[model samples]
Target: MSNYIVEMLNIRKEFPGIVANNNVNLQLKKGEIHALLGENGAGKSTLMNVLFGLYQPEKGEIRVKGEVVKISDPNIANRLGIGMVHQHFMLVDTFTVAQNIILGSEPKKKGVFVDLKQAEKEIVELSERYGLRVDPKAKIRDISVGMQQRAEILKTLYRGAEVIILDEPTAVLTPQEIKELIGIMKSLINEGISIILITHKLKEIMEVCDRCTVIRKGEGIGTVNVSETNVDELASLMVGRDIVFTTEKTPAKPKDTILSIKNLEVKDSRQAVMVKGLNLNIQAGEIVGVAGIDGNGQSELIEAITGLRKVESGEILLHNKSITHLSTRKVTEAGVAHIPQDRHKFGLVLEYPIGENMVLQTYYQKPFSNFKVLSFKNIYQYASRLIEDYDVRTPSTRTKARALSGGNQQKAIIAREVDRSPDLLIAAQPTRGLDVGAIENIHKRLIKERDKGRAILLVSFELDEIINVSDRIAVMFDGQIVAEVKPEETNEQELGLLMAGSSKEKAGEL
Candidate 1:
């Protein structure tokens, strides 16, 4: 008879030397969507892990329907009608959608054999009822990320879960797919299902959630009705600071091309032509943003430009100097600072301390060292200065990179790469996982670099970021640059059409 469906009161969780959650409290009203807002490492995921029975809280109690309950494991939580969809998917790549969904709870017909027909029929009905359409027969590896996410959702729903938790649900979805996800959430709400949305995107929180709980540094700040608070207010509550959201920059002054790509083609690890005839250029003192859905050759384009991928038939010129077929280090030496898309692989060494990560590019040379042995003092000083200037929020330079949050890690990488003073600064999804304040700072820094005669090539999936930070926008579709437009002259609709691979005649006139 209670209005509240579930509540976690004064939760405390710890690991090694860190207290992940410090007295965090959360309450969920039945059939209402609630959002958990925080920075990357502010313990949003840690708190949710407690609810899903992934971690046992050192203190505090979990109550369901006003009755205290002990959830010892995920199996127990599942049996209690609680389900969680993790940000990083947990699906078997080799299995079909139906197999993955009905792995443990498969319908039986011949005692030991799974009833494929019955399972497919029920799955199709469930997907249609909830607006989570999925190709149940398709292999998990062959389906799109959006489809995989829907499949995961179906798996939870199939288990008769009345309470669902979605972590960064729209992180990898396209604009259209995001719309579909919102629709599905609405359907679930109508069906008397309670939902929890965990995300960093304030806009998505504003659009979908009923109420939001702000958390910072493992403590619950407060919860507010979504209608009563704006992004500025929500951001300040989460970060404990009055932060600006937009980048303040004058119009770009056009100049000669600084970085040029001519008919470039790049093959990915799977031997696919990821970038097909990707022709683009970044001019001095201007920012050119590549906007597209994921897996449409943005990664390959950046890799080819930064000398990570082999160019099959094209040219990459840095200030009129051909740099195609060059090594990554050689490309860096040729006046290019590339912040790779995958920060973990190409940005920083997780095992290395902050001091060592700061000098990843130029540690062997420069003021830090003479030739062989690294001067620990110089390294520490350099790293400390960057951490202070960038507001990286690290206690010491001796802290391992892995210990830092995703946003802090990104900031450290940017501090090292952007500070090197390269003529061409290639930033790919630079603020993908950063909070609002960090995003504002990055935008300002990138604009400063552009104004100082450096060319910036930004690739991002977030439309707001692409529009706000870019002077010129290029739309990629099916491994090619389809259309280019001035940001001020374009709207999201036109760009959306171009992203869907509309014809030049249709897009130009429409």
Candidate 2:
């Protein structure tokens, strides 16, 4: 009596103090692209996890192809032709793409050991069919993020999965890469693969999905055809408000060069230069946005500036003072605040209390310490104030940094770094895992810093965010900056071309 491939009727899920989903219902049509849209903590992710067999619903009945079945574990779900791509990737860094693709279900030779050649052949065939252009022989660590994502998709297809759930698949991709993903999704749909896309981005949902289901406050709102809904309507439905896509930022009145790198060349741990001849200038009261495809020397450039990596040959000046060889602490003292790209690794001590994470950079300052004695009181007070101002939602400051949701974790880091009021603020992927509200707040704060006469160097993979918040933009290719353009004068096409390693004139100068 069902017309869909998968259905969940009256689903209910609960966690200690939270009713994540309440009497929710979702249905996926065969060979169609479906989207689940919601704000943060809206039960979208919870619903997908339940469908993926990560959680068991306390109440509800699930039917697959009109037959009711129980999926107690991921293996059972996989057997039922279901595969999930998590928001954060699960690929091992040291493993090769082919090795990772065949990790769980490796082909056998003579019913013993592994037959990598057979596996590679099938993997390549699957990638070709799905248009997932990935080099199976390449290591996951050395490949581009877009290619890694393709490998993940290929892994799902290689496992003979028919129902695919993609969680924010394009969150870390560039403009060209996003287009490729969309094309792949369409091809998969044409091949009779049913897709369930979970994302908070309205634009992507509108562009790629046929139908969309909106959830709010752990309750199902409604489902609609994508063609019938507008972004404004989707925004209002998601957050129950009329959201503004653009912020009102004043024009930049750039002053003295607060941060400058001249003839910079940075090397990684292996002593090979990754950033070559990177001469850039960020002036006071301006946000110089760096837009590039991932693996275009952005990481090394940020590391060099933040004291995380050594510069082989460069002159870095903070307000005309050389701070290149200074320690991270010394650089912080010299008026440099950095919101690192990897938040958990460099931004916070996940096992430590939230109060401790608030002063991660300045814990050794005078007010936070007395000689060898630490001032827990001052630290706690400062942490509480930041939590209040930054809107970081948590039960208390004593809670572990890991306990906070992704958005709140980002908020904590932004609060800590921006509250320092440094002369130069380096925010690298500051809103990487955040929701719309958090992104809006972070963007406003970045504009606020620029308006307050603080030079901000923002490096992000999100083109929309970069184009919206920045007054000027720089494109990085390989290990150097290839082009610089004003916001009002550039389109995504030009930027995408630049990111793909083409110069302005070569790409038909705009």
Candidate 3:
């Protein structure tokens, strides 16, 4: 009998114009957390998709517990005890947790109607057993992202998944939630379940993975025991070069105020005040970072400034001109560019081609359009240039935005927003799902823009990014700026305390 629980040998998957996976090999041992590491568009997800039966390999053999099997679809994979949790969660917003989990497989009372009560009961027990504390009755939209992810895990567990594939599980989680997830992974392994973790973040692999396999440009590099390899080695193998963890930048040269927010008050869709009496100013040639836990009014502030949300009572000035109530296009026309936090929702139209998405904001202006008629030739030529400049790996500029990897999608958005060279750039969670190399490039671009005498407002959950990229750090808590400190003078510990509503003196004393 084979020692491996699952083995994919010589897997190759091809798209129209590119080979997504080329003779990649992976072996998952019993009850071990095996990590799949690669850069964006490097075929990590494609290989896992093939395992989950979402796609068929052009050439390969898959062995499950020493038995060769053909997994033709997700149902077949599930029957083989393999389940996958995708990066972008698949759940109906209106459905309750229990309903969503037991959608296709439900307990029928008397073989007529679904016995929801019985399903919830089973789900509760399963959640408890796996330490995934989710409310079975809560609507998916009403729950936090972390809770939703836990429910996704519970779905796999309830379906009797002996092997679970988590693709970038921690990408959307908070630090505390990430720690909890790590604990959950350990518990799952203790119960004799195996895991395949696909991620770009090196820290998580070092913390939890037993072993890691590196893939570069759709080709298998090698696999190594996590204990024997450091982050530097893995990163070099994945990207074919030594990755720089830190961003290098010179001192900022402040100029006149570019954007100023005074007594800004904004309300959310539910009519709740999210940004309360917020006051901030950004000068040309500097980047000011807002550091806060998620849901502390960062989104509201960005929306209000970019004209995506209505400002209840406040003044937003761009070059001393009021832009508080302008339309989104007007705001953009006023030399303000926004790289939104939710890329799919606000940044790009998934159905549109990459070239079209690049010119979304400037489609009406020439040379992209002449007399309101779009020039496809000019649009694609412009997109090709940006693609080359930003190093965005895509099949072609004609590819759909949804078809690209998450990191590559983000790069496209950044390319479009930054290439405009606006006076004030608002970057919200700009490097959220990017790899180390991509993050380095993004930081350099932000700094390069700042050096061009543009004011930048950077809002992010990453303390390392906030400290490394920002000229000044603004600690936000409870919908307001609690304190402002120079990046060089503060550390993550102090920032954490401030983000938790601790006073500077209290943090210092502690």
Please write out the lDDT profile of model 2 over residues 136-159, one tens digit for every residue.
889999988788888888888888
Candidate-wise lDDT, in order: 0.88, 0.87, 0.94
User: What are the per-residue Cα lDDT tens digits for candidate 3 across 77-181?
Assistant: 999999999999999999999999998888899999999999999999988888888999999999998999988998888888999999999888888888899
> Which candidate would rank higher by TM-score, 1 or 2?
2
Instruction: Identify the superior model by TM-score, candidate 1 or candidate 3.
Output: 3
lDDT (Cα) of model 1 = 0.88
Comparing 1 and 2 on lDDT, the stronger one: 1
Model 1: residues with Cα > 4 Å off, grouped in runs? 15-19, 102-122, 254-256, 268-274, 344-359, 363-381, 393-404, 502-510
Q: What is the TM-score of each candidate against the true structure?
A: 0.89, 0.91, 0.99
Per-residue lDDT of 311 in model 2 = 79
Which candidate, 2 or 3, would have the higher lDDT against the true structure? 3
- Looking at candidate 2, the ten consecutive residues that score lowest on lDDT are 432-441
